[model samples]
Target: MMKAKTRKPKAKSKGKETPKQIAKKLEGIGDGMVADIKKGKDPSFKTQLRGRSNVEFDEDRGILTLGDKETTRNFLNIGHARKFMQTTMVAAKTRDYLNQNKTASIREVYYELKHTVPNSKENTFDGQTESDAVIVDLEHSVNTIREKLNLHANPKGTLYGDITLKDKMHHNDKFNCAKLGRGGWSVMSRLEPEEIEIVSVNAKYVLVIETEAMYERLVEEQFAKKNHCILVSTGGQAARGTRRLINRLNSEKKLPVIVFTDGDPYGWYIYSVIKQGSMALAAHSQYLACPEAQYVGMTLHDVETYGLENVTERMKDGDIKRAKEMLEYPWFKNKLWQNQLKKAIREKIRIEQQALANKSLEFVATEYLPKKIKEKDFLP
Candidate 1:
């Protein structure tokens, strides 16, 4: 018989009320004061001094006090006190959120609130510690709500979505094929590398692919059967898990990787992400790129060599424009990227990996895959 399940207790929110909520409550009290004045009576401190008044007028000291216990000894009027209370409340909350959520990035919180909250206004607090604080409690609340509801946390790996049988089967086939290329020997013991596995790949060659579809197709066509090397897919822009895996492949495995991507600005940026690390988090630089990783491609050169003229599509004007701008940018002025940009301009087209599909799986199985394997030189 199954044992009874024990549930864990939820974490209390530390009763930390947001400044907006505090401000709203204080504003209500101020409204009450206005009502009292309009009623032809001096605002009485008697019944108004109930739960957490957050406002006090010290007649003896000629001062007013807002939320904190400390007194502000000089105030012109009730309006001045009210403004102080509102500003103080907002400032205090912003400080609290930043201090408490160290992992919570300001930009992340800002975007989260901007997208999730209606009419959300974002402003930098000019006072001490204000520049770093983001006022996006609504977004933060969504995360708290999800935790309370016991919803599944978002996927943590580089690859997103469910791992299908087809994916696994394809991975298995590639693993087996690579083993065949090296005289039926396997460098990797497992068919599926751990989500964050660190393999000792020192001085080995690593090949990085861009899209899952391409990876799947290449594996299915048995490209690995002709090449004995480590293969990885960026799974998009080196997500946390992907970054970890790449680090392991580089630091532990000691493999130099070569990046193969679509010949577009987005693809070039993706390669830069793996190489230079994402600007979003500057901390991952030493952990991601395999410093020696050169770029191979679905370049304009490939489009012509493969006789895919008709298959090449007109470059989106925006992409071409950005590519030009990127060519001038200091970071992207390298010979490899310049070559890619020049090709994109001269060809007036962008060819996708899918264009290779029309070349027939037989052609991929017999010629292209073999050529790539023979040319593979990422390994030291």
Candidate 2:
């Protein structure tokens, strides 16, 4: 048999960053583009794309990762020119925002660039997608992620916890999460940990609830205060801000994190994104995932365990498809998760986090959660 040739890996850049490296990086990108224009040369850029086929899970690191391939954008290429132009415009706008010490959402970036080009029907950006991709590109190119470029995506998720911090950006005053009333602080906005200092904490662990309703119930019951823990809700799928807070809590505060979600593929996915990161935003895993986080309940076994038979809904075709697809994923190949998926297929049913309500509103918080935490019943 003939031997197959194996290619060597590309060597990485070895330069270390100096002080004000970020500011210089932003300036360098813009300066290069201007130099290209001055020389009558078309501009170009590259970004690592995230897709199902290209995403892989690093077992040791416990986060999804991108492949070696890169997507290129050049002004001379008709197919990519418009987006390339939009990206450069976005970078320029972000530079201004950063210089001025301000932030703007992806939507704002769209509107800021949504204007007709001179003597042309084409607009700088027809929709938000054009600008959004550009921001992700910036994240990869600059080797930094955050809205300091004045480029930010719409923030998602909220947090209630036993953390006390000072907001240096706005009020420059101290605030405690435990002291907040029923409504906790809105963490959907950009969470600059440096600005919000943690003064004191009563939490031994952090509980990330899947459903907003359950989170509100826990908040109303003063769950974090009573249990001496941090309570967080992503509202649905874990968002960037929500994940950042969880990762910060786990890595920085040395806190154990537990997640509660329904017994379904989507719910399971929520847990996966927190524990092992997701395919879409895998590149930003450093701040967006807490691989140490674990899932507690709402598994197929929980259906029988909790007697949630009546509340169980029939699993749809899509639900089954998602579960089967998850079985093939490297990170989800463990026997526990495989069995959980097989059980769901055999049962042909799905249950929501709200199904815990069948017992009582407080059953999840008081009975289910405490027992799970004590037993250390979590899926890694």
Candidate 3:
């Protein structure tokens, strides 16, 4: 049996590799291609093939990770030539970003590299998708994240609660999420330890809410302040940045993570992605997934226990299909999850977090959440 890889706790300020160090790695890749050309061999770029088929769920660790499958982009092959060229261009531009100590969004990187090819009418890249794919290719090949290469995606999600952090890279600002009031601190896309520092946490646990409306309701009720927990709003499916922040908080601060979502397959899946890592970005799961996270709300049982069936929506065909699919996933193989999935499929009913408002606006913040958490009521 293959032994599972054990990850170490990340240091509070494990700064990223310097620009020169990253450029050296990029240069090695270029040098290899040059040596291949000198030896009259086909120059190829090899990287782990990304997607569902090339990923494996590590049951012990509860994270989807890249499997051993790999694909090569060979320069001599007609089909692979275009991609190979695009990948080379992306690597060179990323080296530039590193050497210049500059940062850019994925979109910015695409535009910066887009131009007419010399002595040809064809453009270097047709769209951002091509560049984006190559960037990920570089990431897996180099065994580093894009943030180290001074690249980032657009930021999403919001955080509110009793946490204080410092931004060392830009403006050197230190702020507390609690003091930010209603707006809360925007979770930055580049939340790597080097950029953001977690100074102190005055919370018992972190509550990640799936919807913005529900998050707002809790905030209005001063849920975080009263319960002494950090509140994170994913808005919908969590972006990579949001997940990473949650992972860091859970791992570094040693705080428990509790997820609240609608009582439906889609919402449950969102919680799953947060806890076990998604296949699309599985390569970086060690730094992103929070395996310790537990589902806290919107269960089918809650629909009955809280008298919420009156406000529950009938499940759609897609929802039922998703629920059935979850029953087979290794991570969802537990009896608790199996019963929930079976019940969801049989009942064909889904409840939203907002349905708690049927009782009262403050019901969730004051009663439902407190009671559930106190009783250690959670779905594995």
Question: Highest TM-score: which candidate?
Answer: 3
Error of 3 at 376 (Å): 1.2
* Each prediction's RMSD to truth: 18.5, 4.2, 3.1
Model 3 C-alpha lDDT per residue in residues 174-194, reported as the tens digit of each score: 999999879899998889887
Better of 2 and 3 by TM-score: 3
Superior candidate under TM-score, 1 versus 3: 3
Judged by lDDT against the true structure, how good is candidate 2? Answer: 0.77
Clashes of 1: 7
The segments of candidate 2 whose C-alpha lies over 4 angstroms from its true place after superposition are 1-21, 37-42
Question: Would you list the clashing residue pairs of candidate 2?
Answer: none
TM-score of structure candidate 1: 0.49
Q: Rank the candidates by lDDT, best first.
A: 3, 2, 1
Residue-level lDDT of model 1, residues 1-380, one tens digit each, is: 11112233224342244334433443554565568668865542211111123333222221221222322211235644433333334334433443443223333333323322236452333332332221212112221211111111122222211111122323433222232332222122111231113322322366667776666666665544345455566545545445545555655656665676665667776776666554333222333334445566666777768898888788888888868766764445557668878778766788776677778855654665457646862211
Query: Model 3: which ten-residue window has the lowest total lDDT?
Result: 1-10
Model 3 bad stretches (over 4 Å): 1-16
